[model samples]
Target: MATAGPTPFDPAAEFDRQVRTLTELGYPKLSGLAPERFAALLEPLRATALTAVAGEAAGEYDPESGRVPFVLVVTRELAPIEETMSRTTLHGGKLPGFVDRSFEPGALERFVATPEARHPGRHAYLILEVERGEEFCGSVPLDAMATIAGRGRSLLTIEEGVALITHFPQVLVKNKCFSLGGSRSGDRRVPAIWISQKAPKLGWCWEGNPHTWLGMASAGDRRATAGSSGS
Candidate 1:
């Protein structure tokens, strides 16, 4: 055969690859923690996210293999993504670069940062997936949401932000884009989580917020979209 052309990127595979690196890196304290409690806390987040995603559409959230990957749109070019997942910070998991480390040696009964989170620093990538509505976002400023909407987009919550930080610390927010007329306004922005490379060990915070870019159009812009329903 002749020379092969380039191929498109596989989001799922690429996501898994990124996650694999962390797993390989290893969470020093993962083995020591109570698997039951850790699994229990994680389950609720997964359930709620899955339910919210499923309520909107099928295949939005995947639980088959526990990949739990989300789309991360980069509003800006190569926004810094996190690489480490730390426990709670001084302000309750609201600090940069995994500052207030909390391995919680015996606090398994309560909750402490995993050893994996104690890592010094990591690289990150800012990714984005099209979101549905304003169900996940509770911390985002209400006024900001309205202003952004006027620019041809809407604001959603960063549900995955916590999980992303807790696990990968690479992604920022689990945001969404409005399907109404397929927003294509160049000025529109959507916050997203970034994959990391050599960034600091930024534990978790609301600063990594990303914005959507080039508009959120599926087929065309400013046009009504229709779908068929079951009989």
Candidate 2:
């Protein structure tokens, strides 16, 4: 018998994967709706279409041109940051996610989108072209922000960060995590995702600080078509 060829990359399958992930993670309950209802909210987005981005790895692709790597991001409108963070998993689901005490109530809400990183404000959507920013490892978040902006890229938002790890837990590996620079609380805290004790963590770092294991995550664009019934 002949060996089977490699599986083709399918955007529709990828979209289904994201929808299934969310439903299995109890996103519907968190969104105060039934699982079927929540899934319905996302079904229309499948028709939004995708421009396939080709890349074998995170840092190998060009962030400035062509279609870059992308991720399906369900925004904060569906779930608060703390709830979303707790839902994220890693280490094969052996560890619970954490939200540092320093965050306090409403602290995360203060982290609004930067002028350069405006999003569609949809409940769920695709982060059209994203980068984990492994190439910026050891670079300060603030400095990396400048470079990302200069290159016309937007930083990843807190919700987007959670969504990335939720769907692609493997991306939160040691020595190659990423910061959510697109969302800022107007001080120095830059929300980031890193491996902690072999489990995924939702934590923060000083914008001016640099860590050998951390880099600033960015995106080429955010795309969400308005649902016929409104977002």
Candidate 3:
């Protein structure tokens, strides 16, 4: 018997492959929260405005079990407001505007700095866990993973993390979205990839290509046998 050589990595091609796989797996419809709904979810941070963004359909197939997981692209924008009663109450003093003029860019960082900020604004992805006969799990932010892990809170399993990236590849790709400085000339867009169980224990890592090597982690060895759908 002869072993096959590793396949060459091509970011663009891998992205197209994942998107195509998602579509074929039956993730045809994409939905997102309206601006009002987004705002409601971000109500705690009244100074922050949430704008739901457009998303694409995605799906992944498990070759081992012949199962397919599907998902939708969902995004939200946060704009910092200068004043809010909530901020005044939390900080014990009226602080400056939530939006920092000196920062120039990186809205997500600004969101995390505020005393009441629950999440990082830029390049941050939130995952909502769904389990049968259970209330919807609270939103989990990707940037806060280390903190959560440090605190020894087993709030999320590796499988959940994998599911998150599978459903929202945009989160990984959009990390550097603002690096272009508003210049649209000859800019290159990163491709997205979906990590299946056959790929690695890192759940699913995608950024342009499956081999691009942006980051990796052990999501653990948790498996879903059947009737699992990305909702």
Best by TM-score: 2
Candidate 3 regions exceeding 4 Å error are 1-3, 30-231
RMSD (Cα, Å) of model 1: 15.5
Query: How many angstroms is residue 2 displaced in model 1 relative to the true structure, after the best TM-score fit?
Result: 20
Give the clash count for model 1.
Answer: 35
Writing each residue's lDDT as its tens digit, candidate 1 over 1-231 gives 352333333444434443443334332233233534433322323232333234334333432212233422211111112223343122123554332233223221222212211111121222233333323233233344444456543222222233333443322322332111211122222323222333223222232242341112111011011121100
If both were scored by lDDT, which would come out higher, candidate 2 or candidate 3?
A: 2
- Measured by lDDT, the strongest candidate is 2
RMSD, candidate 3, Å: 20.6
Give candidate 2 regions above 4 Å deviation.
Answer: 1-7, 51-68, 226-231
Candidate order, lDDT descending? 2, 1, 3
Candidate 2 lDDT over 128-185, as tens digits, reads: 6677888888987878989988997788888888888887775676788889988888
Q: After superposition, how far is residue 82 of candidate 1 from its true place, in Å?
A: 13
Answer with 1 or 2, whichever has the higher TM-score. Answer: 2
Query: lDDT of each model, Cα atoms only?
Result: 0.28, 0.75, 0.24
**Pairs with backbone N, CA or C atoms under 3 Å apart (clashes), candidate 2:** none
Superposition error at 61 for model 3 (Å) = 19
Q: In model 1, which regions exceed 4 Å deviation?
A: 1-32, 56-197, 200-231
Cand. 1 TM to true fold:
0.27
